[model samples]
Target: MATLARRALWPAVAAAASLIAAVLVAPAPAHAHGVALVPGSRTYLCYVDGLQANGQIIPSNPACAAAVAQGGQQPLYDWFGVLRPDAAGRTTGYIPDGEICGGGTTKYAAYNAARADWPTTHLTAGSTIQLHYSNWAAHPGTFHMYITKDGYDPTKPLAWSDLQSFWSVTDPPQSGGPGGFNYYYWDTTLPAGKTGRHILYIQWVRSDSQENFFSCSDVVFDGGHGEVTGVGGSQPSGSPSASRSASASPSVSPSASRSASASASPSSPAGGGSGCTATWALQPSQWAGHFQVNVTVKNNGSSTLNGWTVRWTYTGGQGFEGAPWNGTLTGQPPNVAVTNVDWNKVLGPNASTSFGFNATGTAPASAPALTCTSP
Candidate 1:
């Protein structure tokens, strides 16, 4: 009996060792096939929104920030990892309703939130567009593109029943690689009559492995070519230019109440003066549903600036949390006016200073362009 038990234990140990070896030799788990880029998917575009020049992920889009606030930064960093290793090309009952965006996995669950404020790609209905699917970890696969059925409401959780197969491509021509401009490219005509907001659900069903990847690209059929909203500004229409990086540029025009951009010229000052410009930045915060705003006042004139004032309106229902620092705050929500205190009022030519305040609310999709004035 003891000999029999020893033999059984040896087999178990051998199997365990084999499994460990397989795990050790597998590709990095965080890296995966990739997500939609042309009409950027939620995770892909949010990753683009939050990525700073310093390699930090700080989302400026309210929807992106809310997703980050719920799931932290891993989902965005692993933006391409929204997959189910055991799915085996399964749909419907496999990935539950309401969690389709995240592939029914907790790692990317935040993206499953039902909201209309997500960064959006604009396209015309029935137009032929090139689909650029990333090849982060290239493998033989068939790409299935699905669109939400007509009259679909984006404010509700997504259900598989809402999607209808639109297009698919098998092993399309490949270009770029493991990083920038890398993707499996193909062109297909979009389904006709899709208007307003809808989710484009994509599945990369690998022919070689059971591993499958999913992406949710929020799009609108509003006659616009390929401009995006809620991510600082509109992305250039058409395929992403070679000069564009994985993270799209955030310096373009602002998206109404969702974000703000500096005007071409100094905004008309309260007293018709125009010697200063103000730019606002959202600072890192530890709490969810809250943000810190930092506004910098720069003097562009040749003479000394004896005093400065900055004013802006908030349209997203954000309210101040506490008294501001280094400045005096006045007015109320939807309308904010700030002026420098005694210690930091004066500035020489080309000099700058900043003031900050905390706010209680989800980050707005856009910030109001700030206008600075001097008396």
Candidate 2:
């Protein structure tokens, strides 16, 4: 009996080890492909660093000395970076300078001081805190950054001083350029409520190689009192603006908000159109595969449609296919499905567009209806 129990325990232990190995080795998919810009490329890098503590810069770390060694130096980017009070302050905001490293051979960046006001919760003696970090670009690999508390120390290695950490953002090795965004959270504790002034230093470098790239940001935490002041800019905002939201089931209205109908004609082999009609007819729904559905779209509007968006609710398990400029559905659903059109297509006064997807369950006895929005 003892031998049998031991055999079972061995297998369970082995299985757990295998699961751990898989998680550590698995890689994330890359959003971008290759490196396009160089150090001196036409584009320059920008960054911002800020902090807030108990009303002063706590000189518990040697961040300042490290910054001076790197050649580029500046006082806290802005005096009024961000102010927060427990009773009212959100305790969060962007750093000053808005742009850190730019247009030259500058490698190091620094944020000299940050302070929190009185009546604020400060770090207790020997407590651990965490800092959150994120990357939003197409760089091929990960990198390392050093942190020093109090005043900067030149003799000690920042990386070895329990003050440094490394983070990786790439899944597969590639060239370099702009990649997707990566997030990291770090922590360290303080020695009692000894909060007056504090300093933080940040250094950027490649993950696989020693080559340094553009920008990076660090989220700092000291006990319960914290701030997001950093040495770089927040990721660039408002670029390929696209977003998606999902509805678990379909919905129907009592009266059709908008309707359209088309009259098939031979002269216009494709189809003919009228400018004042608001009615449209859909051909019998067809199955793309055991798990997919497809539908044809027609224009039944009076004027030309610069673009159109169609939305519908599904009762059967259904899914969508995402597009580069649009969203898609995938995987088998248990009950319903939905589809959304893009904003780029243009339909003539009576023109049309067609798009659809696969579903898990059988189509409803009555075909789901479609509605079009014209731009």
Global lDDT of each model?
0.67, 0.26
- Give the runs in model 2 whose Cα sits over 4 Å from its true position: 1-126, 138-145, 149-182, 186-195, 213-223, 227-375
**lDDT score for residue 128 of model 1:** 77
lDDT of 1 by residue, 1-375 (tens): 011112334578776665455333321236566877666788877875665423346777788899988998767767778898988899999999999999999989999988887877766799876666777778888999999999989889999999999888998976544543356767779888878888898999999989999999888776644445666443322232311111121111011112224122222222214788777766433134455555667788899888888888877888765445445676677888888755457778986655556576876666676788888
Per-model clash counts, in order, read 6, 63
TM-scores for candidates 1 onward, in order: 0.57, 0.23
- Which digits, one per residue and each the tens of the lDDT, describe model 2 over residues 186-225? 3333333333322232333334443343222222223222
lDDT of 2: 0.26
Worst 10 contiguous positions by lDDT, candidate 2: 248-257
